[model samples]
Target: MSIPAIDLMTTLRSGHSTSPRLTWYGPDSERVELSGRVLDNWVAKTSNLLQDELDAEPGMRLGLALPAHWKSVIWALAAWQLGMETVLDGGDADYLVTDRPDSSGRHDAVIAVALPALAMRWPGELPAGSIDYASEVRSHGDVFMAHTDPSASVCAIRAHDGQQHLHEGLLTGFAAPHEDGVRLLVAAADGLEAALSNSLGAWSSGGSVLLAHPDVELTDKLLAAERIHGK
Candidate 1:
């Protein structure tokens, strides 16, 4: 019962550890690039945070209320790696991760995420029971060790429309298609599901992804500068 997400992350770490796996462009001239190893580190730390601090485990629904951003991507991967289901619609979750902490009172635990790359902590006061992700994630281990492994048949993603995607079918059935070794550009306007699907397609095919913010114009110069091969 091999987990596709875990196997994919392992492949990424072992294959091209130094090359940029995810590049992001946002407003205010924000450009962030993460190599395979760095991306794994972020995912590992996040998984550790969920498992050790929050007691996240298999079959739990982790709601992601955030938009299509790098941090959101990391959170999704972390949830999958920990055998938790990612609820994209952000409803009926055991733990909810959101930027708007005030609206997440129903969940058992809430995590406030700051989207900025340089943010060391949540900019404003969080709700009384919420955790600040930016401040707390750094203290966790860079490597993660799961206490329990999820079967391949375990549900992975709960889509916005309530469709469930299992771990075994995540890459082959759910992900978008991409060329081998392609440098694909994914737009934020395409939504988080598209971004995740495209990224999985790219990474699984030994390619990379460039995720552009909705506000960041996709210009000819930018496309050429990034050496993008496909959308």
Candidate 2:
């Protein structure tokens, strides 16, 4: 099913914000406020661009190379505001460019993401049929806004075919709100404890989630993630 077009600012004003919701943990310092301001600006700019795409197609899916940084959280939220799907990948996953795997029954435009510097290894390319996140969003200019609604949902999980499965869903059910009756497909990635905790929290609190693990196989994905990424 397709999502509905929404005014992100209006959505936040109305109580159904789609901007990504993030909880950055850092030592108490001055940079926190400074970083928050910069982040808010970036999110504001990204939100408008995504909102336009979502306005055009509520069911649009986006491939996201989720960097292990605070900014990644904001970028994911912007996509949610537009009601678009977000496919998560490793920071270096962009290297999968030539080998972008074809998993979803649908197609996606990959972006060459500029990830934050970290010790973790990055994905070399995007999936089989995706675009470069960095190239796509690099030149896009939009200052962010602080006051935005960040209530939409997006997440990623590993699929059976060695591909990623991204999922999205409505924040409110039309007939039965939060009844597990409606689930939006979203991005895919190795299961991260923190990410799942956040996604599940949203699902239970009447917010959208990135995936639905009604089957046992889905749990295996989490195990695999732990095996690979768990230090």
Highest-lDDT candidate? 1
Question: Residues 176-202, candidate 1, lDDT per residue (tens digit)?
Answer: 888899899989888998899889999
lDDT of 2 by residue, 1-231 (tens): 322213322333234333333333222211111122344445555665454332323334555444333445455555554444444443322122212344443333333344432213235754454544444443445553323333334333332234443333333321123333223222223333234334334433434433322232334564353222221
Kindly report which residue stretches of model 2 are placed more than 4 angstroms away from their true locations once superposed: 1-37, 49-56, 65-68, 88-108, 117-193, 196-231
lDDT of 1 at 222: 90
Root-mean-square deviation of every model: 1.3, 12.0
Over all chains combined, what TM-score does candidate 1 have? 0.96
Model 1 gets an lDDT of 0.89
Give lDDT: candidate 1, residue 91: 62
TM-score of each model, in listed order: 0.96, 0.37
Q: Model 1 misses residue 118 by how many Å?
A: 0.5
The per-model lDDT (C-alpha) reads 0.89, 0.37
